[model samples]
Target: MADVACEISARGFLNSLLREWTGWSLAPAAEAEMEAGPGDGRLRIPLPSRGSVVEIAVVHRSSVGLHVFRLPFREHRAGAPARIMAFAEFAAAVAHEPAIVGPEAARAAPAFLGRVFQSLSAIEDALARAPAPGLGLHADPSFQEAERALRFGHAVHPTPRSRDGFTPEDARTFAPEYGRGFPLRWWSAAPDAIVQGTSRAETAADLSAGLAAEDPALDRRIPAAAEGRVLLPMHPWQAARLTLDPAVDALFRSSQLIDHGSGGSPWFATTSLRSLYAPHARVMLKHSLSLRLTNSLRLIKPVECARGLAVDALLQGSVGAAIAARWPRFHILGEPGYLALRGADGAVLPQTIVALRDNPFRGSGQRPAAVLAALCEIDPDGRGSALADTILRIAEREGGGAQGAETVALRWFGSFLDLVVGPLLGMQCAFGLLFGAHQQNLVLGLDDGWPAEAFFRDCQGTGFVREFLPVLAEAAPGLDLGSGHRFTAAEAARIMAYYLIVNSVFAVIGAIAIAGLAREAVLIRQLRRFVEALAGTDLPDKTCLRLLLDAPTLGSKGNFMICFRNINENTDVTDPLAHYAGLPNPLAVAPAEVRP
Candidate 1:
């Protein structure tokens, strides 16, 4: 089962890679060969520049246009051996292409392969364990179940599960998919050495006490000798690595920083592995780690931490109230505060930083909110998606059979648009606020297998138009809307289109189609109707909607190219919008039906 899951993920990676890199064209001759062949057939991708053609056996073709290919054969030369290797091997072999290889691929390949292995192991573990019953659709599903449900990571990313620094043991112990929890390592920072953002709590100690209130064991662990110091919690792995830092070492030697080792009740890892969740608590902790996951190192930069606090403050003010009035179901999981230790040179320590995130699912009365990514995940058994099964069950309850399923799917899609897309556009047009509403960053509140509410999280990717600075300033006085968080109107529009439209909305539509619940074209037409209605309104900035309707191509982040170039997603670039490549606009291709 794990092998099957890994292979499916590999095919997805290849499909995304081919789409992004190399102008791979279908050979006329290869099409003829496929037609002539019996049963399943092979397709060839002609790489003219490389003077090689790659052949793949078609396993399954998804309705959404994602091809699942197996038994890939790379023909380097006419007489050379047609090597049949695993997907990771094939990726490494192909990385030799100047167009595909990033400066860091050579350094990143080993780590990428290691992660693939870890992903397979994790998948095997999941399959061995008994499946959680009923798609976890109770009034409240276990947080750990939702977190672990994401066996496979980003479908489009070449190395979705790759973590550079972790061993197999570490992967099992730390990865969210493994469902293991461990105590956080504790440190003591002198009062003067603590750098923190303003929150309901006045000091780092105050925040620590608030966190400890959730678990009495945590409070008991605080030593009397640490009375004058701020309690600092760190990921155990991060703590072990910090010894190599000269500045941190010097601070430890000077008594400004004291290592208190691991203590406190275990905090479970969330889908975003660095973020930990205490189910009983009202807050989630986003901690900084040095390990590389997917495109970037999982460390929280000082600027990002500050931006989170600023965004949280902005959302709590008049701007937030205006948005809430417009769409009450659209919730932003605010990152209210953060704490970090400063070095002797006054530099903020990235590894020691922790951001406080709101926990919306604290009580039993709250509707079950599951990560959207988890819903889209392919079950290890390969029977169907959790989302598809849930939709089918709902359809059965409503009536029965395929027609009923289609009705439920269409209705669910419409509600998703109302709860998620409507608020996203409202925020952009009304407040000039752009949310990074990618699948992993969104949690959908589910009631009877339908999307009831949409919750957006992770403020690091959130942005605002520079034109709205005055409005934001008035709403949240003294808040620093950093230049990095500010975007031009055009930039904001493009980003909203990519994150909210291309990644989030289109992704959900595609997932629905791929699950065989409904047609992609129908869902897309529904989306078109929704956007058209919004465009007709007197909203200020409907550029995202207008662009989606009018643009020949839409901007999509080039994860393959970004990874190849070793682009640090955390680093501030002069042109942040340049990371995208043009993807054919689905809305433009499939026009909405003209109304009478």
Candidate 2:
């Protein structure tokens, strides 16, 4: 009993002190063998659930044995006890709650004893297998000379300590709305905060109200309160580094969506607030894609988004910049942009990722017609002007410079095709449609109320199968699919399905959705007209051609619809002319692979 208490007390001190300060928790106790003998043993306590497993080794001085405490994965899956408490604070808490140790604990201890002893058996087995002294060129160590020993390996470990190194100067300031739940160091009297719900509305409201009543100098009006909704301001550098302009900053300060859309509810439709600062500060505020239309969708995880943004910022700043010279309106913001946030855990929030838009798209409303008119008004003579030069270059290089509308469409399609199948595919499996032809990813350069240039934005949404696997492995190495460092082919296939069917397809759908909501017929009419013009004289099916040409409509493959599109066998096999027949897709399931 004395030995058990001593072991437990030593472990309890570490768990209740050092580990707690470092945001670590003690797993249920486990048994470990100290040496090959039956009496040599101790208990081990595991750290809390983190990306990696950290074990606390406790040695039983008398028994000279070791036991490891590990919460069974099954138990963790079932219900593991976890508390984010401070060491000093929680020690006081435990002292006050002595009832925490009870008959239930006694019962739990015996179960842990069985597990600990089992582990000790394995340790003893290992020690027994150690090589005899003088087995190799050198004899065992001085200490090992008294006993048989095996080769030794080295390891590194961090000593557990408090996260108290965080100071007021290190305090990362964020807008009140985004401040909840984030760890912060403050000089003020009242600074501790915890988010009770995932709703941005509730969090923002509480934060705004709290700040207004507390701080007098700071202007609360920065957060626009519309329909009881507040736009929460967040720091950009922590999770992602997206570039933006002053206009985007102002947009972040002034914009507010009707806060009903839940976090990561992919289908939740709401307004978008964009501000860019690539060339100059340009702000765009629009009400669209909110809870009414978007509740069914799932947003990608934030870590996944961070990876994409890093890739984009790196690529666009280098190789992409060289090619982007032709598309002058496509701008890259040089610094990170602020964000509005709402979500639980590390989930992606339904917030804008601001960047500099040198020339912004006039969303499907009034400004589009002007852009279209500008495209038409360009000099037909094909001399001077960058636009004409590009068109001529396309004519000379691609399809024998097919003239008129055919030449333009062919050039556009050919450029898009080359980008996707070439550079885009070379990276890894990516998500967003390689070319977000829709207004969402596209912007028109305006020269005197006319569209003189066209560009694509949201490059971060672009994805590759190869780029993601390493990141995924780093986060969870067990998920690695063998074949060394690269992702297994099976993993690649899954990513391909997600990229093509979910990300790319849905982007197209979003474009279409924006189009369908047109208050004026001009947007749709001009689109149809452009399609007709592009398809002139070519006897291709106009419906199919329009479907392929119209950017927004082509991009709308959202989640639910993707499940339907993901059918196994072309059940229409009997219809001899089924679309799936001889479709050379590697992802296509052989009739044999399908479930019987």
Candidate 3:
């Protein structure tokens, strides 16, 4: 158990280090100074401040430059023969001095390490439990299992499972990995106190009532509340935290906000911890969690909430209908409405806000849709990834072996591009809208283990270009599509490329390589061929395509740097494209010929 814990911690630390190294463009000249003998993965890094060199053995090296190293140096201070420490310890030993490393990083190191350790502990706890049966996607899989199957939250993120505000008990109950379901804490809000962002329904009360109708128990609970008041559901954690706010407290005291407490059909926490899946209800509820998860607090900001409705309204128009007609397989899980409590001063209670999301996997035609992140996730039990497992099955049916696996991999990758990448590009080029098509936000529908359809979620991270504002306004008037989230052509191109190409497509290829199903080089060639063919089309925005084909480096989000700087991701920057650093563009490199 201790060894497993240590291993987990080391992996987290190495991921952090890799992000810092690559994202910050750290001097590789220093790394080149060390020499590794033939078949030797050992390297000695000089620690000038410590006046010593730390010897490390390479455990694993990712194609994206994430290298996990096991420290094998003796502890001189402790007088131990040999000691093993994670990257955090090694970073402290070499770069703790304020002069050596920046003051911000020096201060943030302890907090970052603490989160990494917490994440490691959580992952260890998750892995200790018996591996869930068959990738949680059998002939007919439960939605909860598909959600829980994403044991590790983020692929490239350093502390993907870290929940700073959560206690051990809270994690056991609310974390997706535990597969625990609990009733949401309910609140009865006066009609005057309720704020509706934008809804197809007549009023805010109607929206709340509509949501309640999904669950019979919840519906029953609503009428039992104070007369003329609407029932609003809240995450228990958020409900508890809201008590600290003076405005919310005032509302509670005035009886404007009646706490009905937790009672209703239980909702299971999805992979994105804040979103809850109500299996019986066939609706997903995204609540505002004040608790920090990954980069930011999982709260639905006012602008973001508005953006959801704006997106929904836009998608209901002629342009949206055209998109649907062109690419029927591509679906957007719309956030049709949002509800929140407003104080006497017209201030929104952020903690009380919740967005109503569409659940595509409720009934027939639901067809096993696996979150792309979950599909890429490596099973701790060495059973391989859901994606690899699915592909392997297909390969076995076609004729088993390395050659068969490669053939299946190629076919799957091609199909994945047509279903996912093609539609995403079309949306961006034609509509000037870009979906945040990262692995987590994308759900790929599988037809007998082959990619058939793609569904995208999360409106908050979606991007729109300024150049297309007039066109959008003409298409959908009266909608506040202008949330100041506009991006320039270059900015939109970079952001889209980073999310779709670097994060989604490249990450999947890396996963395939790690699974030993196919080489990354082959996958890269396949991606290039697909893009080159697309480039020949008469597309509106060739910026992304041109950049992908011509650019020497691609933008990559700096998660480690973001943590080190302690930036509030919500309001830190006006331009999100600035959050990324230049990374080597694999697509631009000389393409390998496809195997005949």
The candidate scoring highest on TM-score is 3
Query: What TM-score do all the candidates reach, one by one?
Result: 0.89, 0.28, 0.90
Candidate 2 ranges with C-alpha deviation above 4 Å:
1-295, 298-301, 312-412, 415-439, 442-455, 459-464, 467-596
- Looking at model 1, which ten-residue stretch has the lowest summed lDDT? 32-41
**Model 3 ranges with Cα > 4 A deviation:** 22-46, 53-62, 65-83, 86-88, 91-101, 129-133, 136-142, 202-204, 218-221, 363-366, 381-383, 592-596
lDDT of 2 by residue, 189-302 (tens): 111111112112233234433433333333433323322343332222222221233323333344322221112101110111111111111221111111111111222223
Worst 10 residues of 2 by lDDT: 153-162
Candidate 1 residues 1-596, lDDT tens each? 64565565666566667657654544333453453243235656544446666666654443333444554454544777665556555555556554455455567666455555555555455455535434544333444567767767776676666677877678778878777788888888888788987545454467665665456467565655577777777778788889788878988999999987787777778888888886666678888888878777888888887778778778778888888888988899988778888888897888878888888877435556778788776554333566777788788777868988888888888988999888888888878898888878988887777787878999866788888778878888887787247787788888888888877776677666666788777887788889889999998877777888888777777777666555677663446578777776767754534221
lDDT for each candidate structure: 0.72, 0.26, 0.73
Give per-residue CA lDDT, model 3, range 1-596, as digits (tens): 44554544455454554544622222233352253322225444444555545565554445554344443333233345545555557646533634333566567767866777677777777777625546623442445566788876666666778887998788888888788889888788887898876646554456556556766666574556655787787888788889888889999999889887687778888889999887665457899887888788777888888888788888889878989999999999888777899988998877788888878877433577788877877655332677787788787777867789888888888899999999998888878997888988898887778877888999867778888889899998777877637887788889999899888887678667767777777788888888898889988778888899879888888776676566667767666777787777878876643342
Ranking by TM-score: 3, 1, 2
Q: In model 3, what are the clashing residue pairs, if there are any?
A: none
